[model samples]
Target: MAKEKIVLAYSGGLDTSVILKWLKETYDAEIIAFTADIGQKDELDGLEEKALATGASKIYIDDLRAEFAKDFINPMFQAGALYEGQYLLGTSIARPLIAKRMVEIARAEGATAIAHGATGKGNDQVRFELTAAALAPELSVIAPWRLEQFREEFPGRAEMIAYAEKHNIPVTASAAKPYSTDRNLLHISFESGMLEDPWFDAAADDNKGMYVLSVAPEDAPDQAEYIELEFAAGDCVAINGTKLSPLEVMETLNEIGGKHGIGRVDMVENRFVGMKSRGVYETPGGTILFTAHRKMESLTMDRDVMHLRDSLITKYASLVYNGFWFAPERLAIQALVSESQKNVSGTVRLKLYKGNVMGAGVKSPVSLYNPDIATMEADPTKAYDQGDATGFIRLNALRLKVGSGVEQNAKK
Candidate 1:
């Protein structure tokens, strides 16, 4: 009988490297390693060779950068999907994209199961599994962190390193490094190690090396940088009149925002599995885009529509944060978000200075701000009628007056 083939989401990291080898030894199955390239840049170095050398029958490295930006990141940003009004949903949004491709690859490779290196205590496990269940219910998921055999054999990174050495797998992990990081086009995040302490400052000497995307805010340039962003139906199409692809837009903003020390967030967020985890993130590009997008919407969107979208922002944010990217309710909300963006076309001028993004000005051809009626200067030929205010105020005040009278009667 032929051994069952399994697809593994291989990152070539310490934990994933061991999982690849252990899966082969335990199941006597063929492992097809897969890695999604979502703008990890130099981190993809030597990943293919490393995977094959560590018992992978074959490997697939797919470039999902464009797809990640166009489909996942931008849409969430348009909906203002921020977890707890702080986190950009960086890791949470990427999991579904990774899982979707993993399912497709599993089908092509004739694999029966898909495996991931997410620990049992983390939210990635839930995100990966829920997406798998939603997309391909027939396929089985292998979570090594939840398995006692895997956990007992490799209790921590130290044992994993020992296993790699014994098996002759080339790995660069060590106890000295201590913490873990995840990176993509939108942001880079650091967790565990010294970052596990909520009171520990990430900018301290030992942890300073973790920030790869931006400089310290205090170290930024003294002068503010001004940039203009053009949006069409809520999507940023150009910066400073230069049109670029989705990937280029993110990269450009990252470079520009990093120079000004734009995006840095540190918080303890509630995980879906009933636990809290502290993480430090640098999202230079995303911060600039979020500020500009909100400012643009204020110029072009209707007041009631904006209010309705604001009311649903928290629920929409929760859906993405809680691993429901593939859920039907999320799709439904996204449709509403898309509909609300139909008229959100505008240009917003922003000033970036020392980690702050402020809107200098905003304008749209479809703007509802009527300056004629809003102007305070008196005009002899103005369209205003002062007599109209009497009926308007009287009608609006009638309810308040009746309520006051009722309260007086009750007191008497």
Candidate 2:
């Protein structure tokens, strides 16, 4: 009989590299290592060679940048999904995309099981497992971190390093970095390790090297940079008059926003697994886009529709953060988000200074902001009647007036 095959999500990092070798040894199976290229840039260098040398029978390094930016990042941003109102869902949003493709590779390679390096205590285990469960329930999931046997052998980074040394597996993860990072087109996140302390000042001089995407806001250029973003159906289509694809848009925005020290957030967030974790993130492009998109909606989207979308932001954000990107409720909320964005096409002018993204102007062919109706100086167009305020105010105040009268009667 052929040896049982298992697909492993390998990142060429310490954890996954060790997991690749361990999975092969423990199960005595043919290990197929898979790496998803979701805008890790130069980090993909020599990953194939490393995986093959580390005991992978076969290695698949798939480039999912376009699909990730266009399908995953775009739709999630359209819904304005932010975890804890601070996290841009950078790491959270990329999990489903990575896992979906991993599932495809597993099916194509006829692998019986899919394994990940996420620990049982973290949220990633939930995200990866949920995706696998939703996408390919037939395939079994092997979580090495969750297994007591595996955990016993390697309780922490020190033991993992020894295992790597003994097995001749090369790794970059060391005792030096107790923290971890995850990156994609949307953003890069830093957490764990030295970042666990909520009071830890990640922005201090000692931790200056931690920021990869942006300079410190204080170190930014003195002058503010201005740019215009053009949107189509709620998606950013152009920046500063240059048309760019979804990938290009994110890349360009990251460059511009990073230079201006935009999108740096440090906070302690509640994990889905009932733990509070501290994280530091750099999402330069995403921050700019979020501001521009909301400002554009202020000009184009209907008040009621925008209000309804605003109401769903928390719910949508929670769903994404909790690893339900493939869940039905998320899809339903996305439908509503998409429906409300049909007319959200416009150009927003913004001034980026230090860490601030302020709106300078906004315009759209279908903009609902009527200068004639809103002008305090003149109303020559007769777009809105001043006399209409009498009935409108009275009708709105009727309930308040009635409530006050009821209170007064009770007092009497």
Candidate 3:
């Protein structure tokens, strides 16, 4: 009988490389390595050669850059889904897309199972599995980190390195930099290793190597530059009146924003696994998107509808952060969010200087801001309701007056 086949989400990284070899040895199964290109530039280079050398039967690398930027990143930007109010949902957003592709490969290759290198303690395991469940529940999931035998065989990085050495696996990782990182088009995230310390400052001299997309704000340019973003139905469709695709728009803004040190955030966020992890992120394009989208919403969205959506922003963010992207609740919330953006068509002009992103001006054909109704200029012909002020004030003050009277009566 042919050996059972399993598709593994491979990144050519230390963990996945080791996992690829281990899966072949332990399960005696044909391991097919799969990598998704979500704008990790050179990271995919030689990935096929590395995977085949490390015991993979075949290697598949799918370029999902446009799909990632459009379907995943753009929709999250539209909903303003910031995980824990700080993170741009960079890693979180990429997982579902990667998993979706993994399932597709598994079906195409006639594989019985799909595997990932996500650890049991991290939220990525949940994200990958949840997406798999949503997409293809029939395919079995083989998570090595959660397996007792795998955990006992390779207790930590040291054991994995020893195994690789014994098996002649070519791995470039060493003990010098042990922190784990995930990168994509939207942002780069750094966590674990030296970053595990809660009180440690990410800006310390030792941690300077952590940043990838942006420089320190102190090292930014001295001059400010202005950029205008045009939006239609909450999606950024143009830049300074130049029409561009979703991917192109993001690429343009990333270059413009990174040079000015626009979007760098360091925070200790609550992980879905019930632990707090300190992560430093650089999200230049996403920062510009958030700022510009808010400016558009301010002019277009109604006051009460905006407040209602704002009230649910935290809940929606929590769901995404916790790896519930495919859940029904998230879909319902997304529908409501999309409905609120029907009239959110406008252009937002912003000034970027030394990490500051400020709204310079905003305009829209469907704007609710009326200068005539708000102007203080006197007009005798206008049907002003000055006489209704007495009743309005009395009605509004009734509760406060009743409370005060109750207090007085109690004192007497």
TM-score of each: 0.95, 0.97, 0.95
List model 3 lDDT by residue over 199-302, tens digit each: 77887766666677876767779988989999999899999889998888878888888888878888988888898778988899889999999899999999
Error of 1 at 337 (Å): 0.7
Which scores greater on lDDT, model 1 or model 3?
Answer: 1
Model 1 global lDDT (CA atoms, 0 to 1): 0.91
Q: How much does candidate 1 score in TM-score?
A: 0.95
Taken over the whole model, the C-alpha lDDT of each candidate is 0.91, 0.91, 0.88
Error of 1 at 256 (Å): 0.5
Give the 10-residue window scoring lowest on summed lDDT in candidate 2: 170-179
Candidate 2, superposed: residue stretches over 4 Å from native: none
Checking candidate 2 for backbone clashes, the offending pairs are 178-193, 179-193
Q: Tens digits of per-residue lDDT for model 2 on 102-164?
A: 899999999999999998888888898898999999999999999999999998779999999
Q: Find the candidate with the highest TM-score and give its number.
A: 2
Q: Residue-wise lDDT of candidate 1 within 66-130, one digit each (tens)?
A: 99999999999989888898999888889999999999999998899999999989989998999
| C-alpha lDDT (0 to 100) for residue 103 of candidate 3 | 93
- C-alpha RMSD for every candidate: 1.9, 1.2, 2.0
